[model samples]
Target: MDILQILILAIVQGAAELLPVSSSAHVIVAEKLMGLDPTAPAMTLLLVMLHTGTMFAVIAYFWRNWVETYFKSPHERRTNLIGIVTATVATGIVGLTLQYLIKHIVANGDPHFEIEQLFGNSKLMAAALAAGGVLIILSSRIKERSGVELSLKSSTLIGAVQGLCLPFRGFSRSGATISTGLVLGVSRRRAEEFSFALAVVLTPAVVAKELYRLVKHQGIAPGASFPSLIHMAAPGLLGMVFSFIAGLAALRWLSSWLESGKWYLFGGYCLVASLIVLWVN
Candidate 1:
């Protein structure tokens, strides 16, 4: 990719990764529009790196709360830790189950495949986006009616939503999962925190999966022969740094705005994005 493409991808990764929007959807659209090969191993590596960058941003932004809640417990620290672990486990089960089911079941009979096949279908993506959007809107509406507060059950529900998001590229995992928490009575701040925490936990697995694919395909380590990997990494790192700085700003802004319970606005965005994707593709 060119420097301009790198910058654009970085910006999209940085912003959309944190926002309720599906960064993957936007990136895929951009790839197709730019005539870039979505199946290229090097490009996939760059995407993983971009995800890692955002993961770092989440950690940097939430370090304080993480320490206070996970480390500074005067009592019940063990319980809190267990709750976090249970939620993580639940998320993993759902995510991996769907992944395997799709790889084995959906693609079972196919003799040929393309990397773009990872996206499944645009129509499916559109449906997922719309579904997630409605859930978010309803969650926000519920918060307005009865006030929002998150608990263990709500977190589990969010984890369940994350699992469903694993296979569907455009579902917006953060949006659907966060909205699940909100609708189930999770506070906006906690919802956001849990969302990022889940991201951090699951990111390693996602990167590993992609790496395994690279190894299987090329019969060698990735980033070895692919000069594009190096090129992609540079801008990915730059974009990640920018995203971290920008995320801190977004977090501050989101805290107050979320309290106003305007989550439904994202539904409109998803609806519009769906139409745009359909129109283009």
Candidate 2:
């Protein structure tokens, strides 16, 4: 890919990754439009950098807020920690179960089958995107009640929604989890905080998996020069800088829309994006 393509993807990944709209969908769409294969080794390396950039952005943006919210008191911290754990457990159960079903039933027990096999299916991605849009729209319409604290049940439901997002590439994890929180009467601020907290926990695992998968795909010998690996990953550093900047900006935009009750606009955008994905394919 050229410098222009890298810049485009960086902006897209940075902005969309933190937004309620699906970042993966946006990135894939941009890559497809540029005739780039996401699974290609170079692209895989780029993706890792992009994810790393966004993860850093999340920490930078949310650190202060998390400190105030989660670390205000020992008891409060413990309670919130338990909620996080519960949600994570729920996400693991649902995500793993879906993968198992897809591998066994959909793939006819093929040991080599990965859920990624269906990722390139345009129809499925569009359907998932459309479904997510509807969910976001409906959740946005529900009046947010202030002082409505998040409960374990609500957190569990949100986690389950996150799990559901795992296999569907176009379904936004932040979108689904935040929407579930709203549906359960969580305030916009709390929902946003919790959703991102879950993200911080889940992202490391995803990054590791992507790294392992891409390394295997690259088929590099154990004795390969470290600089050679760095060189391959270097094209993405510029993207990382852009993605990080974009993530901070996107988070502000997302907070504005969500706080101002304009979140339905994201859903509207997702619906249009879904159509575009289907149409282009």
Candidate 3:
């Protein structure tokens, strides 16, 4: 890809990554228009770095809040840790099951089937975006109760919702998870925090999975190919830096938008965006 293409993907990813907007929808559209293969090893590696960049942005933004809340005391640490663990377990169970079903049942036992191959389907992405939009709109209608807090059950439910977004490219993970938390009566602030925390925990595993897929596709032994793979990642490192800078700016916009009582507008935007994706396709 050219420098312009890399910059476009990086900025789109950084801006959309933490927003209720669907990043995959935007990225896939851009890739298709650019004549880039979404499933290519190079693109997959770029995706890993893009996600890593946003993950760092999330940590940077939330560090103080986390230290004060989740790490303040023994009781807080224990409780928060359990919440994170249970939610992640729930996410794993649901995500793995979906992967198996998609590969085995949906693919009719096709040995070479990979869900990532389906990610660039514009119609499928449009449907996923529409689904996310409706969920966000519905959840936004529910008012957050003042005393409601995160609970184990709610976390599991939220994580399960996140799992539903795993296979589909255009479904917004942040949108769905935070909406689920709101639907469960958690305050919006806590829901956003927990959603981001879950994202931080989940991103590394995603990066690892993408890396493995890249290695597998390349027919390279992981140990021997390490240096070569690192060399190939050099261009993506630039994307990571660009994305990190954009993410910092986008994070502030997201916080302000969330507080502006127009969040449901994002749902409306998603609905319109799905149509635009169709047109672009």
Candidate 4:
């Protein structure tokens, strides 16, 4: 990708990565609009790099709260740390298990990434978008009914949604997890905090897996000759920096909007956008 493309992708990555909209869906759509093949191994690597950038943004933005909540009291810290770890492990297990089941069993050992294939599959995308949108809209509507706070069960449920999200692009991990949290009785602010914390920890491992795949494939030769990793690096890094700043800003806006319980707005957007994707594709 050229610098201009990188910038466009970076902004989209930054905004959508944290937004209730599916970042992967937006990115894949952008790639298609640019006439780029989403299945290219080199492109996969670049995509992971973009995720890495946003991961940093999550960590940087949430550092103080994480440190305070997770590292201040010895006992409380240990407990919260274990809770986070437990939830993360649960998410990983679900994600990896689903990935294996699909790759080894359902796909008959095919190594294809599901998102790359299904993203442009308008029917599937529409279904997932509609399903996720319904769930999010319903969850937002129910948040006030059950006024309970967050706990381990809610966290695990959110993490499980995150895990399930790994195999599907339009599913929107954050959207699902946050919705899961809300439906399970977690407050909006706490749900956002936990959702992002889980993302911060999980993104690196996901990136590493994609990177290893890229290296094994060797030489970026797909629809177009692969750009040098070095060339890709600059854009990825620049994307990360830009994303971090944008994420900080988005966080502020999200906090207030989240309190207003306007999550259904995003659901409506997804529903409409899904239709648009169907029409375009």
- Per-model TM-score on C-alpha atoms: 0.86, 0.97, 0.94, 0.87
Candidate 3 C-alpha lDDT tens digits along 1-281: 88899899999998888888889899888888889988777888898899999999999998898899799999999999999999999999998899889899879879889888787688999999999999989988988789987999999999898898999988999999988988999987788889999999999999898889878887345676667877778868989998888888877876676666667878888999999999998
Can you rank all candidates by lDDT, best first? 2, 3, 4, 1
The whole-model lDDT of each prediction reads: 0.73, 0.90, 0.87, 0.75
197, model 2: CA deviation in Å? Answer: 0.7
- Give candidate 2's root-mean-square deviation (CA, Å): 1.0
Candidate 2 per-residue lDDT, tens place, 104-149, comes to: 8989999888787898888898888888899899999999888888
| Top candidate by lDDT | 2
Pairs clashing within candidate 3? none
C-alpha lDDT of residue 257 in model 1: 60
Candidate 2 Cα lDDT to native: 0.90
Candidate 2 Cα outliers beyond 4 Å, as residue runs = none
Error of 2 at 34 (Å): 1.0
Candidate 1 is scored at a TM of 0.86
Top-scoring candidate (TM-score): 2
Q: Please give the lDDT score at residue 118 for candidate 3.
A: 82
Per-residue alpha-carbon lDDT of candidate 4 for residues 9-128, written as tens digits (9 for 90 to 100): 777878788887787777878888998877776467667777877777788778888887678889867777666787898898898898788777757787655534445666777677
lDDT of 3 at 192: 83
